[model samples]
Target: MTSTAEEEVLIGFGTTCYYLVFRLMITTTGYGLAALGSLIVIRTINLDNAKSWREPKSIQLLCSLIILSCFTGYIILQAAHAFIAIKAGIGGNPVSLAMLLTDDIQLFLNATIILVGDFVICWRAWVLLSEDKFWRYFLALAMIINIGINIADPVYDVPNMKSELKGVFNVLDWLSVACSSIVNLIATSLIAWKAWSHYRLSRETSIWRVGRQSHRARWVLLLIIESGALFLVLQLFALATETGSSFSGSTFDKDLTFVTVAKVAGSLWNVSAALYPLAIIILVHTNNSPIEETYYAGTQHTPVSLTLLGNMRHSASGGGESTAF
Candidate 1:
């Protein structure tokens, strides 16, 4: 290769890296904003009722903390990366400049935050599934492994063959995706299938099951399925990068695109998670009260008593008998 062509290749690589840095900055900022929005939505919802929210308030609060921590950590890491990239572009030593200039460490921290977030998601999924002890152990093991991998990138020194070791670090970084994706896909598929089956049975047999018309469960299932799909796409790209194909660039670009889309989808999931409990609360309160009576106390029993008598008659005549009988 000619001198000019070699320099051009280096320039191109640098430009690509810089472009990715900007993309990461923008994406993480958006995620942080979405996190703030989710926080607001959650606070607005009254999730104090047990029947509406299956998870305890304490657990939900813990998950909210993890979500916020992950958001803040990612944004901080990206901002640090941007600063380092700028310094490096000006002919500074990339490795000696600063902590953020070391992409390996920064990426490891980012991946660590994401993995913790993934485990919280898995915990929520497990709660929804009511699965056995095995799932709990499995998720715990995966979380431990992911944390170990994240620590290894910065803590384990292998300066001799940094390039090859860096690839190994990349593999570790993607392990969360691999493990969580598989688990989520299977669990979500099962949950959706179960919810759908219950809904169908409710319609056919007139049974009143907990999850028969559970929009929350259905949305959780959807979130899991979507998360799994995104993870699979990411896994395929990781494989492409590993195999040393020219198409890896395309895969890398697609991976970034997925990250962007996933951040948006994640925001939606946060809203869904928070809104699910709130919706249940509203629906239950409405069903249990007389709207007209509540609105106008003077006209209370006129509409309220009639509706109550009608419901009782239907219940007695078995017109609206629930199979829970």
Candidate 2:
């Protein structure tokens, strides 16, 4: 293992030591970082003397906690699979049927985690596009199919892992990823469009508005970001890794570069999954989230005009009661 020009000894296989350490590191560090994010989300929860637990902030808290719990279960399954593989490699033994069964559960959890994380991102799009019936239905139908594939993939994977039906499984996996990626693209586009429209609406409606003019640009930036576009940034990296994994699964010596890319990017994804919802929670807490009381509040349905806002005081100088909140 020295830097000298000597022959390098290889391990039993690619899936033994390399994979095990990746699992351990991913579960440990990813969970720790997600837990820290959860703490920040929890801090946003108010112990108000007047508000209910069903408040928006509390709901964010609950979402974060649930996501973390699901991620924990997934990590446990991965750690267990990695543990069994490591022991088998050390003892110069083949994995038993039961260990393969454990692998099945891990695959199931993998699908589950992806479903939950993607669903959360879809949920953001849903909220942002609340008034757009077309997008709402489109997203709903896509997610329904996404859900079907996630469920069916694991069922097929269990048998395909032992048999020659792996190609079918691969096709299903590719479809699943394609479905989710399309949804992500739509969500990102919609959010960006909404942000652009919102900015334009703000400019037109509120020249001498209530807030600082400079802040509008920042708010529009935050609007797109808080809407889950950040997840797409991480999603691209994860997809690159997934593409490499698709080329050569559980291989190191043959495609070392791709394998390393797959493993490293996947580890980043473990944190990025939880970071999706956690990012929303953080924005909601920081008041960077779009106005929670209404979706697309000023862009449609009821356009906000600052004309009244600018001259309301002048009009009210006659001392009639002002009705604005």
lDDT of each: 0.46, 0.64
Residue 225 lDDT (model 2): 64
Q: What TM-score does each of the candidates earn?
A: 0.56, 0.74
Off by over 4 Å in 1: 1-10, 13-17, 41-55, 97-105, 131-173, 207-325
Candidate 2 per-residue C-alpha lDDT over 1-325 given as tens digits, one digit per residue, 9 for 90 to 100: 4543322323434545786787578678878878888888777656453266654455556678777877778678777777777677556565767578887876776676677677766766776675699999998898888889878878877886676432232666556666666777787787677666655554554433457475767766676666656666666766656754554334532576766776776667656767766776677555566533233222234322233333444444554433332
For candidate 1, list the clashing residue pairs, or say none: none
What tens digits encode model 1's per-residue C-alpha lDDT throughout 1-325?
5699768757755764656565665566556554664465466444555443344444444555554565566556556766666666555454443643445554544554445445544544454344357766765576666566546644543342244432233444344344544554554454355445434533454433355355555545444343344444444444334333213244543475554454444334332332232222232223321111111112122333244335545655678753211
Candidate 2 stretches with Cα past 4 Å from truth are 1-9, 12-15, 46-62, 164-169, 207-224, 240-244, 247-253, 290-325
C-alpha lDDT (0 to 100) for residue 244 of candidate 1? 33
Best prediction by lDDT: 2
